[model samples]
Target: MRTAVTAMKIPPSLLSWRSDSWRSDGRTDSFSNEYFKRRNQLKRLLFACLVRWFMTAVLVMGTYLVLWRYSRKAAMISNKKKEFNTLIIALSIALGLNIASSLKHLDLANFEPLQRPKADYILQSENFSCLFQLGYVTRRHWVRVYVLFWVLVNVASQIAVASLGLTYNINSADTIAVTTPGVVAIPDMSNIQTGKVLSSNSQAISALRYTANNYGLVALAYGFGDIDEMPKAGSLFNSDGDLMYCDLNSCYYVFYEATPDNLDYYQSVATNRSISTQATCQSWRVLKGGDGTERTITIDNANKTQLTIPALNGGSQTTFMVDPDRGSGPTWGHVLAFEASATDPWFYNCNVTIGPVTNVQNPLQDVGVNVTSLAASAIALQGYGASTIGVSFNSTRHFQFQSYPAESYYGGPQGGNNTGMGQLMASFAVGVVAITAQVNTNVNATGLLPLKGIELDITSWTYVHIILILTVGLQLLLAVIAAVIASKVTIRDHSCVGLAAALQPLLWKLDNSGSSRTTCEKRIFERLGDGVKVSYIKGRSGLYYIKADE
Candidate 1:
């Protein structure tokens, strides 16, 4: 018997099926292939697919093996985001192509018949409800578990690959050996000229300086690169005794710590505790004649200049030897003495030191060394072409009182008349840190070496390889299984319209008088079984039709 089917009027959405996708080896009734002959053809197709599966496996495995070996060191990349993204994109494209090739297979054994239920799992792999269709067929056809396995593995590998960067250590960043100018003071600093700290147009340093315009004139010069608008480094009178330096986003800190040392001289006065809190303690006082009862006026033996604060009741005694010549020639160098009365516990004599800090755990805490005299240089510039920045501090320039004024010790620097000794010390420190930060900003450094970085954490970062393995591995394996039993695998557009059109051959055979809706079509076919022998033929109007025999 011979049956012919013309094109059906299908909606645009449902007509998307590629009806001609399958190759019809049998012609019309005159050339119809017997059932056993077609079955043999399916068996040969199965063998060919098995060969393809093995080739796919070898291709995927060998490609990844070469990749894994070549990336043993994986030389650190400076632009991590760019390079890593490139790698992921390349893999995604390659995987996509490989997956596309493996998708349209009727993975089957040589003798198995293509059944309605089996085709459901095979052909519907590209459907929107593919997961659901796969689930339904999985009861009798468990090969879909392999598909689900690959899906789950891909999800897991993707998550691991996304977070892989966080696991990397400093080795992931590219590095180069470099010999740079070390920290110096005076000639040591001058010899290693850091790039000039700022452009001539910038008043950032002068503005943040504790000294007025005249005093900071020496430090204001066009030396650092010519960036016009730059971030200001330290605040004016930043008396926290800590400075922050930044380069290339990495940061460092300098903290000034005051620790009490062995007393050079201590004289007990008959003045009461109230004497320690006198107005002279408000600002660093140019000490005049003391109370004259127990206080004696005397010059420092070394420089003859002195800053004195006679303790008032309930306050503290603070005195520092002043260097008159503004030159480094005194026996004592630069030291401050604060002697709280026997009853007062608030203030004590201490020496100053600067500590190196990579992290800032606490801003209030003071942290590193005894300051006999500070004349060292801090390098702000990084790499070649960096301008040499130098800071030279000599004279005792006055500073805005930051803390501990006798008038209101609890208040922050209120009613202070004398200059803070540490304020002067802060001037030196501020210049060091600010200059460094400024020069670093111009050069775009993270602070020290620009290339400082970490290596890949192999334990976690290797997830990229696993992504390839699971994506390619199970895909090939399952593609082979999904290809099982069916004679032909459709490679054209897998649209519902195309599929419905191709069913024209079965149109006249199945029962659809009352329950002929699309939903009942599957049951109708299950009841009838896949026994029809059909062929696709090109018609004269550039269209194709279906022919079936009974």
Candidate 2:
């Protein structure tokens, strides 16, 4: 013990009272000498130990703080989890709103043509698109969420509706009946004349004679059901007011042309032949049976069937129903009707009366008045009578009719655009699952991927949302608490605050060994029996040293 104590010699600078207690302030000070001489050994050792412990505490806290600060940034890089969440929300909103709006537009696309613009009409008529745009723009947010909810809700609703549909069956006249295979034809002929008090055979003969006379030119040449030429009026009559006649059950002679000279010759040559014509024309004479000359059919007049006035070919009219109370109107298209007569009757009477018929066209009045009024009146009307049971609706509803809600002309994705929310959600789920699965196989499993990831199935979306709400919200809450605790413990505790504020920089200046340099110095001087030679150089600030010859 005596030998160990003798071998330990303090450094020359530490031996001096000035160097032990005082620090250099640009130059050596006299106070340094006074302090060293006055201070005791135990006080110096205690101060040294306090400084070492303070520096050690500061370094530990600083490293922990650095790591904590970088953790959020690292999470941003290794896991795009938050980004996917935001993306899913935005995409869901965009898709849901557009889809719902599209359906709403479809419901009313053809109800009022003016409400939906023509393909090029949006640019041409701002008035037309204005109504459509107004409907959707204000409704965008609710519509999007509504659409998504609808998609989910509709799955259940459709199943219920399907079960309901099974309760009743509805079909149109297009259904086939086993009793009838084809159209049944009826025959009538009051057009042929020249008869009174005649027997069945005589009446039949008269009918045969009349038909042969009228249609004989063609029948005599080509037999019954045959035309020698497209028929002409005078083809069957001879100059003598006689006919090229045929009896029932015989083929007849051909008479393409005839004059007075050939009448007898024709009669003799046609002795073995007789032909009959099928005349289908019927006639009805409506004598003025009613009290007044001005007569009306009164066809369900209270129900208001639109009777198109009689006109020559290619003519029409336009009209509208205006609600006096509501200040609104529904414009309409033309109507049509036909009349018939008998003389010169085969096809000429009704044909001449109503000129050539053609198809009618209109945007609003595609369906006739009867159907249009039923659909239109079903909605709320301003002037509906008190007696009316179901004029306008109290709430909006979806109704289907043939000519009413035709295909919509607005708010649809053009040309195969995959802009729906369903697709976006599906894509995010797929991407997340893929990355997470890859990382679970490849990287350390402790990463963020293990904590926040999802599968590609939409059926599981609700559960995923629930999990996210619980997980993220909980994490945010915990992080807030943890940050508060960490800050108080790190920055507010008296010793920790002092260590950080006071001793951190001093330890930072200790070169490679840092604050451990004192241990290294003690081992060299006290245990190794080494002495260091100090060299004084003018204007130098710190001690310079070399190992003394051992």
Candidate 3:
């Protein structure tokens, strides 16, 4: 039982039939022949190639012409007098056009419309109006031009601003250190419960007072530095209404007035308030967050104690000394710290209780007895520079720390207080260093060989490259368009016989036995080609042409 096997090659026609079968059903183009007009296709392809080449040539020539023309015009105008006149006239015309456009779009004001709209909570919500204000700016040519000019002006202005910053002599910032007592031990303050009012009026006063009493507050005197020269000792004074001279301390004249510290000032501020639960007055707690890097100290009016020290002079740097308590091992305490402007020193609100405590053992000695604590003996006080001021005081009441308040209460002339001069010099020095660092140059260090590279090179490089690319691209594009227009003029569509000859292959024939009859009838009705009409009427086959002799 053997099976016979046969192999046969398919004919071309058979293969064509098989290909047709393999064609995707319902997917073949329905009107593929519509684009197969050979004569029309030839004309279009020729036109496209002509247009492309013409455009390329026109672009090249136009760019060269524009640059050359502008350069020649600039060179010919030698006298500043003529140049100025031309420039002014051109600027005036441009300005007038800009003004007219602005006026045409001006929105007139009406009293009713001018009335402020009620605050729309929906619109005010960040979600509804995120970046919506950007839409108000109109995008117009004049506006763009104005913005460009403004940017250029600012670029030039920065030089002057930088120079001013360099010239401004900054004195060291002023910082005050209020003396405090060292905490030997925590005196079993666990018996004192939270929310209990230590004041007689049942009003829960700030526990900071008791804490400061047990554990002294160590306040850092910032912005304090060496002065050019010390002022007369006649400027220094004590709280006892007596002028005291310290041979060890240097004094300096200050421009602002001072206020003597007294107990009456404290009592006047912390008055009794209505009794409330600790929960209700929970706002009194100075909530500290993070590693004290960013802490918030919030106190309500009822729980707040206001003690007005001498008002600081407005816009002036003050100097003060950082004096430590003798025999008080590493005095540590909590104090309200204040930060000055970039040019000023970090100041402290001297805790009235923490400074020169009275009505106690060793009263009026200004001992470091005010703030002692149990957790840590050595506390940090703020010093000059942008460093953190960390200090643990005598009181076990630990509070985290962070940036200073948004505003300062200082209100006198700089250097008015005797202690302000040194502080001013120190603060100024720190501020200068900060400014120098911000400018990316270290003070007293030879900046990099190219100082500008550190400050502005990157931005300058970016803009330079951008300008180069844009200018080159724009020139090329403009030249292209110009060349295209110019080429359309220069490259006349002179009928090229060669192009016409090349199209001969796409010709078609209309002469046939039946078509000849039709052609004769059409030529007769069209009143064309009398010869062709006659030829068609005579039943002769030939090309149809119209002539007078026909």
Question: What is the lDDT of every predicted structure here?
Answer: 0.34, 0.24, 0.24
- Whose lDDT is greatest here? 1
Give the better candidate number (1 or 2) by TM-score: 1
How do the residues 71-136 of candidate 3 rate in per-residue lDDT, one tens digit apiece? 232112123334433543453344334322222111111111110111111112122131122122
Better of 2 and 3 by TM-score: 3
lDDT of 3: 0.24
TM-score per prediction, in order, is 0.33, 0.13, 0.17
Scored by lDDT, model 2 comes in at 0.24
- State the lDDT of candidate 2 residue by residue for 1-550, as single tens digits: 2243343443432112223333335334211111221233333333433443344334334433432343223122223434444444443344334323322221111111121112112212123244344434433464345334434432432333233223222221111111112121111111222132224323332232222222211222322222332223113223232222222211112211112221222111111111121111111222221111122212223343322211111112111112212321121111111121121100000100001111212121122222222212211111212112244542222111011011211111112122221121112112211121111111111100111111221333344334334333432343334333322111111233322322222233332333445655444234323232221111233321111222
Runs in model 1 deviating more than 4 A are 1-88, 103-106, 109-321, 326-332, 339-469, 476-550
Backbone steric clashes in candidate 1, count = 51
Best by TM-score: 1
Native RMSD of candidate 2 (Å): 38.0
